[model samples]
Target: MKRPGPLFTLLAGVVLAGGIGITNLVTGTGVTPVAGAANAAGAPSATEAPRTEPPKTAPPKTSEAPKSDAPARADYAGRVEGGGASVAVSIRDGHAIAYVCDGKKVEAWLQGVTVGGKLDLKGPKDASLAGSYNTAAVTGSVTAGGRTWRFTAGPAKKPAGLYRAAPKVRGKASKAGWIVQADGSQVGILTTDDQSAAAPVLDPAARTATVEGALVVAEPISGVDGAGEF
Candidate 1:
């Protein structure tokens, strides 16, 4: 016979190698073919390594507004919008007292508690005052006599706050309200028998006033430890 060609010789070598591998697997002898042997031999692997995820990262934190301390005792006085009325507020130990006066027939007394530098007070005739306070000023609105007005009041010194006197006139109940401003000016009113009029001048030094021919003391309406003198 003629000598075998190169192709036939190569085919014989391959078959011999495959037989040896099969023998190794069946008899547990010699190096067995591993799952990724082709990949190790520089061919692409049919089964790739398990896909790994990148390590998880945490989210960033957020910013917030700074907190402030509440005021223990403070006084605020200011005028309503359009100079239509005057408002005075006093806060002590978290209690608050407010007065809105037009220096004439329109006035209201409001009382409530102060929380987190804010005040919400109510009174007769659907009167109400809502506001916020700080070291610099108190700003908000007041409603009385079916109308509402906004205001801003700065820090008030002593003798510059709300005042009142409720005395018996001729065995009948009478009431007076006053607001002493930071500029030493004053606005007040007297109400008796369902009638309102301008109030008498108050003696700030002694906190006294003469009403209906009777000597009565005008008491400072402090938010501290005392109910308002209606």
Candidate 2:
């Protein structure tokens, strides 16, 4: 015991070499032993390599975002006849309100004019006025007292031959016999021999007779001698 003073025999041989290196790290062939031996190293032996918890990081693939070109709008109504006057025009939203009738009277007289105004229609181009009336198929023209009289859109055709008028005969009026449709009824029997007959009066009358010529007199005759028969 007195010799054991070599620093107590080098601390008793470093405590018996740390108790035989902790009994060879607790059995099974050596070196691993950090308390629970890293939880019984049996399953956790791969140390740093067992830290492979990174495989559960599948939260990065996310993409779905793209769409926008911009362009969608519409609303429309119609009616735009033209420069002689037939304007009822009502465009809305884009604004274009017009109404100035004369084409047989709807009578707006020019309310809410808009769209550059000044639709005076033109009429003094050497007024030889016989039957001429066309403002441009009907959209607007014609002013009258202030002078813008451009009347058109009335006759497309049909106004060339026979057209007498005894109030427009209907029926009843037969001496030499002639009164087809003015409400009198009795169509036929005047005969000078022009040849072309038709008789069935009343209900819109229908009296006509001829030896040769009869362009069109449908039902309204009175001209046996007053110089008006055809």
Query: Candidate 1, residues 1-230: lDDT per residue as tens digits?
Result: 99999999999999999999999889888874788779779876766676689999889878787675557777777787789788998888878888899888899999898888888999999999998998888899999989899999877776777889888878888889888888888889888997888888887768888886778998887654343542
Candidate 1 clashes between residue pairs 3 or more apart in a chain or in different chains? none
Lowest summed lDDT over 10 consecutive residues: which window, candidate 1? 221-230
lDDT of 2 at 89: 22
TM-score of 2: 0.16
Per-residue lDDT over 148-191 for candidate 2, one digit per residue giving the tens place of the 0 to 100 score: 43333321111111122222223322222222211222222221
lDDT, residue 47, candidate 1: 65
**Which prediction has the highest TM-score against the true structure?**
1
Q: Give the residue spans of candidate 1 off by over 4 A.
A: 1-65, 224-230
What is the TM-score of each predicted model, taking all chains together? 0.69, 0.16
lDDT: worst 10-residue window of model 2: 69-78
